[model samples]
Target chain A: MQGDPEVAVLRLGHRPGRDERITTHVGLTARALGADRVILAGDGANRAETVADITERFGGPFAVDTVESWRSILREWEGEIVHLTMYGLEVQNVEAEIREAHRERREPLLVVVGAEKIPFDVYEAADWNVGVTNQPHSEIASLAVFLDRLFEGRELDREFEDAEKVVVPQAVGKRVVEADDE
Target chain B: MQGDPEVAVLRLGHRPGRDERITTHVGLTARALGADRVILAGDGANRAETVADITERFGGPFAVDTVESWRSILREWEGEIVHLTMYGLEVQNVEAEIREAHRERREPLLVVVGAEKIPFDVYEAADWNVGVTNQPHSEIASLAVFLDRLFEGRELDREFEDAEKVVVPQAVGKRVVEADDE
Candidate 1:
């Protein structure tokens, strides 16, 4: 992710109590899937903390923050905007152009992932409105697949620095060793 | 998906009220991303109904069902079993083999998605314990990416039949039309 353009995921319209876990998953997925950071655009301070805790333990070049105004983030964003929605053009159709802009052209990417309903203006503001599949499902999943495609699966092999613990991938049981980097 | 192995997702150890939406998203992701069905291995009747309702509206050959004992379902399962976990073998390393057994050998696939902590036996029972990434993330995201990889990205091109409504892919606007197939 170092050489890749800065990728930030903006989680819009989080309903505090109802979306607590879902929003938390959104942040974690973004971090694990190669996004440099995530901006929570609602009252998701606690969710931000959960992700921050994971980052603290698991390691991070990842950042998580809470923002009061999502619209301004959109208006002031300096790079390419991609809105992930069920109604958008298929990701497979638009991934190449996007990857070119972000990876080849080195344009920063702001990916907008929404909750239940999104405002139309967000769609209009995006350079590409992309869908992992034009069907009903989880936004966390949408972001995961979209990022995977954007990185062309290289993110899976990524090793995090400054970690306190690292998973030792096993065939049959759990195994996590303390980070020797410390 | 028609000719592929019968893929079913088994969600284990669901804590009713707290895991409601996360479980629902699991079921929906399973359906939308090419799984033939999702077997909710807990008290997920309401969650099953929610998925069923979406299936009814969106069209499906997809099925959602609740089981009293998850162990029984796993014990009686007819084909290969895959448990998704962060501590498991990296998916990129094992996906081809898993795909071969399911796609070429025509063995059914039962993908186990866990809630909080999965029992050690689940790992032992699985033919392959796979991780989408050796990093912490959402199970819904793991399932979506795993299925996408297993299907080699063809699932996004899938068309659901008997749908009452279908999304017309857009670049910057929302559009849904009644399925004329009805």
Candidate 2:
């Protein structure tokens, strides 16, 4: 998987717990996305304290690192579909980098997994924007199915393009409404 | 309004960019709560750039400040009832401070806002707890009505003591089934 790459799952967070959630969730997403590789990009780690937890959950050919190191990895991999998931409250620069990476490597679709509203600048940067459209309590699986479709040559049509894209300052409840409406 | 201590409104934030929605929705509530002070907390001024977007729609008297400055103002004000509305997303120490303040100051009630899950530890720290008992997108006014009756001695039988709380992650379009059910 390392000699040539196909997917980079970017989970942006400086915090450890969130990084862990993103790493675990992303690794799970990789198998379904059917990319050549799955990488966890965040500030998380696998320590002795979390080893039991990790083995039980995040099964990985995993490379976990900060966004900078992942950037280095993506450059090395050259052309792969990168799935970007933003964690935590601050996402100003991370989205820019995703858009920039998309511009540089147009081979892969940039599927953004957003926790909250993406900033306005990020939205303008996007080629296509859509909500995950996963039903409530079914996020993990919803994303999994989406990734699977990507592997099967999914174009991310209106179902996805119409997804309620939440940018900054929108209430979480409102996002729930938009997601349901679409 | 701050000088009068009877201004009947308060606007507080855990951080910036987070106060506007809560403040905007809490106006009818203040009247219903018979509140004379609206205390906005946190570094909301520096962190929240969208405050103006929501505040323009606001029609209430509220004081907002960074956490550093709000303390002095809080010490000077006294109320028969104190409704503490705060954002609870990764809080670890809310219980001790809120309880100590309540015990030392004889303030009867503290209303915690912005959490789908009520912090039991924090509630244990205060005299009583209040929360929304409706579906998602329920008006902040409804909650205010409940609190008003709760504080003005009109609805002493109304209770937040045994309220069932729902906890949900902030990811939008993610399954948020449990946040509204009580």
Candidate 3:
């Protein structure tokens, strides 16, 4: 999402077909806002069929990789990470996966959306923890844009210098783009 | 476990120190009865650790290979094949990764666990389907063997066959092990 400024919307969810209603809704909204990728994770109802359906709708260049736990993800971490950890699409081994991700140490634009408030560990890991992606969808949708705003904003790291960087180590080597409300 | 002359006792749930227990118990029970391998699964704490500690009891004679999922088990499928499709493990991507396994229609030894008991379906593609693993410590130990015996010799399949099999196809492949009372 950082590579371009035009992406207006993004919706993360579990599976594709079963979650197609939400994906379609997100796709329409993203097109309205001019967003980038419609990211997905977790096993939705009718997973194989659903993913196949969603893959057809993404009309641009993107990478789809099969990851075994988030540990491998951190080892392969690059710049500006984003986690759909608890994006309303529950899956097996999530707590274990997130624990692995925390061990990996990557700092990107983290925006997680779930039904209820996320557990404490995720919020500490996320740059912006926006609870309930579906209920008050419109309001949280605006929060995604706020991330774009901060990315475009100057001296984004000024907040980091103010607070102790206890979250992650400098060895991770990535600049964090955080928002005001976050 | 009751009908058959041999038995395989599985110590479910997590505890890094299970090997000592497995060694002591397996020798005390299964060894005395002259049973086969006392199969042990879980990350010691319900897939919590990198490997099940029980795999390393003896040095040369008892080397254990702990596979994260059944897909990791490379078996030449011949005879009455058993394909256990539990509703809660992390192996949900099997339709794609091991698509070939499902391609050729053949009977197999399928051991389906979890699903019916778990509160959700998003994680059903997993091998263990052990959502209860996350419950309180007292809640985690498996209840299958005793439940089988309690029911009196009729395996779960005779009763739950068409019901569960309809939701997950893998159940259709096995001659589900029965209990004793039936």
Candidate 4:
């Protein structure tokens, strides 16, 4: 996990009462974009169960968990923490530097995505506060762009292990194959 | 518009009965990520109005329109078309080639994003049918990645001509400034 800088996503401020779909997408996007795990923070309803369902249905070498203290998590992480925010350094400007550092150190990477009013401490704690664009946009989009750049687009070919369902690429129609389908 | 690829996004297969937020994001993402215009295709209720409202509130050098025939639009487009689908070629693999061709030909880029079951014709008609990743994922995410790569992340610095409200990047708190604000 360390050699290639295995990536883990930390989704902060999940408010299920407001928009569950967005929170769910935070985790789903992480998994789809080649993150090895998703850590859901905040008191979002059924956050763990929801991610569990996704892993169960999609099949995964992925993990999901809920945490109460994102600050502690950030402070304790063994590798660099890349915080996705609009106020930070533009991603393109610093991505290669971060990637090189991670590879050389052979440390895992933790990506932080915020859902609510992010505390300033989080910003200060991040080794690299990266912005996909210096504009307020969806966190999902920022994570997608960041991961794409981080991996140099090789994540597109990532294969999920033990997938209960998988999409087969097609030129015309949509076809999803299940594990039971011989 | 031609030399640098004036980009237009066509959001296909919108249904009023379905999710509207996702459709709205298609337009918002396009504008935020650097598309010059977003063409909403299909009978989704208030699709055009939604995007227009976004432009009005968010500020814009961006435009929004609705069309009945995506095929007709595609057939008559003045430049090359790039259709986003999981079934398409990996974006990273083809993006450089497409950019080189578009620049050499001075052709604009029309990016097609689907909201429902896309017809086979789109796959065949596209100059480059591209995938951010060959996985069933959100359309908004795909559009972001595509635009980011197309512009080589320079889109991150694009400034809107007349933004009514804009977020001032902050290290801590959220602060949005209005055009008339002191």
Candidate 5:
């Protein structure tokens, strides 16, 4: 919430034992799709570390952290809140409005993605509850689609500044290019 | 390739031991994003059955099959070929043109998604080698982004007619609506 007006992600409802891989994917999707940072708000302390490790390995101008209470965080955010849910207005219907507001207000945009049964308070607190698709699917897919639209597809070209291992594009074979120090 | 002029997917380079989950996701992404059918090309005979089972359970107007030879299939394809790859032209740049061409020709689209190291011949055979992003990412993510863009996000609203279990959109809690017969 303290960063520049660039978009960030708030992932709530992570259940540690049940959501390890899914939670890590949420963070990965957020970073890969142009979020400047992610706040994992829930009881998944180990999940937060796993996500942080991914960021560290993949390289970052991105940050990751964990918080205990999403209710207080959502209530206190200074910027517009866009909660991703299946029941909300379609993303295409409201993305332009959200983008316009973000530009005019010049405040950080917090895009919320939930992992478990999100409490009713979140829907009430969000400025916009948007759905990438109404159908049931992976939250990772929803975040990917939402961020792609929010950034207008420009994020596809974004490059990580410090990746230790990078894929080298090939016409015939597989090769991962790693840092010389490795 | 024998289907209507609507979209179809060809998933190539399936490595059975390594690409089980990735290949399954490719099928899921294809079905979810509005492709009418997907042909699992190359090795991994069992992968075809896994994908077929998913479609059977999730409900589909979608079709799934497997083939041993992608080279022959690509050569004989009756429609335009659009291969998904990281080294190719960006999807946003070429998607409009591809869509326009498909419309004008009334040709079925064969969208190729690879699971392992794709051979060079694929690049040459494809009518358009489209990149969802230049970065190395999951094939599932790439397929999702590509199909969403191809259909101009309309696919987001599509509903499966026979899904045994469907997610009910909720603002506050999770509920999966199940078919009474099941």
Candidate 6:
């Protein structure tokens, strides 16, 4: 899990019962796509538990936590802030510059993904306002593509440690085995 | 609005109220990430309506429909079938071959994305079972990354015909104007 710049995802605006699954997906996507941790900034405690459970079951150095105030994290963050939004600059256009600021500069990266209708200040707070595509789609998808671009697809080869279950990739079948078997 | 191969996404096994937003994301992701259409196979009529509404407002050649049988669509599809699954072959390893089949060989591509548990028959049905990353994340994320890789990122520049609202990419603010304004 040694990447140049430590990456964290902040999941903003979790509407308790309604966004549980989407919030969980955001956290899991953060873990799977090479982010070191995710801070769930609202009432996403249960979603944190779900992500934590997945990490425990499927090996992780990844962390998930619930925070009361997202603004404090943004205000105190030491490195770059990237907000993924449909209204932001296209990812392809800005990815290389952001990647250099992140990796070459060795600055820790905090990626912010919001639920519907993000506050205006979040955009102002961001060092890079990025869009995977200007067309409306899932925030999970945006985050996934953004991370893939940020890491330049090397994140896909990442192997997690201390996993109970590990997926053995198949061509035409499903296979999940003990990590020892891997 | 022309690409090498016509791509359609099939969302499999959606539960009514629980999967409403996720299914909507699946359809929207398909549309935004350069797919021609999305076919929701289960109880996703309302999700189709939402996607259609977005298309009407944002402009699209994208189509969304609710289908009675996912199996029939798979059987009836005359092109290459790729199922996005965590248990499938890694996308990075197989994308070139699949791309050649779809683009160079002139085969239409059917990308299948499933909810929680897809049946074994689906594994058998797909010509290529592709995984964006062999880790549990959102199917919407998997579909997005898969399409991004399939099209090699050209889809980000796509323009929709006759759109009322188009996002004007910004550095730190939101601005969506009429497509005519462009």
Q: Write the per-residue lDDT of candidate 4 for residues B29-66, one digit (tens) a residue.
A: 78878888888876743667877776787777788888
Identify the runs in model 1 with alpha carbons over 4 angstroms from their true place.
none
Q: Residue-wise lDDT of candidate 2 within B31-128, one digit each (tens)? A: 32333333444443342233322222322232323345544443444543233322211111233344344345545333434323333343333232
What's candidate 6's DockQ score?
Answer: 0.86
Residue-wise lDDT of candidate 6 within A1-182, one digit each (tens)? 36567899999988877787888889999999899999998787668888998899898889997899899999999999999999999999999999999888988999999988899999999999998888888899999999989998999999888889999899999889998886
lDDT (Cα, tens digit) per residue for candidate 3, span A91-168: 112223432343344323323332223344443443333211111112223332333223322211212112211122
Supply DockQ values for each candidate: 0.90, 0.03, 0.01, 0.38, 0.24, 0.86
lDDT of 5 by residue, B1-31 (tens): 1223668788888875556555666776687
In candidate 2, stretches whose alpha carbon ends up further than 4 angstroms from where it belongs are: A1-5, A13-19, A31-33, A37-42, A45-65, A68-106, A134-139, A153-182, B1-182
Per-residue lDDT of candidate 6, residues B53-135 (tens digit): 89999988999878888889999989999999999999999999998998889999999999888999999999999888888
CAPRI tier for the interface of model 2: incorrect
Q: Which segments of candidate 6 are over 4 A away from where they belong?
A: none
Error of 5 at B151 (Å): 1.7
Worst lDDT run of 10 residues, candidate 6 chain B, spans: B1-10
lDDT of 6 at A11: 93
Residue B20 lDDT (model 4): 66
Give per-residue lDDT, candidate 3, residue B135.
14
| Model 4, CA-based lDDT | 0.77
For candidate 1, write residues B32-100 as lDDT tens digits.
999999999867656898899999999898998889888888888999999999989999999999999
Query: In model 1 chain A, which range of ten residues has the least summed lDDT?
Result: A41-50
Model 5 Cα lDDT, one tens digit per residue, A1-182: 12337687888887756566556667767777788888887675456676667666666778887888877778888888988886777777888988778766686788898865788888888888887766544566777788788777868777777787665544433445675545
Q: Cα deviation in Å at residue A48, candidate 5?
A: 6.6
lDDT of 3 by residue, B3-66 (tens): 3322223333323442332223322222112222233444432321212232221111121223
DockQ (0 to 1) for model 4: 0.38
Ranking by lDDT: 1, 6, 4, 5, 2, 3
**Alpha-carbon TM-score of each model against the true structure:** 0.98, 0.28, 0.24, 0.82, 0.73, 0.98
The lDDT per prediction is: 0.91, 0.33, 0.26, 0.77, 0.73, 0.89
In candidate 5 the C-alpha lDDT for residue B66 amounts to 80
Which of 2 and 5 is ahead in lDDT?
A: 5
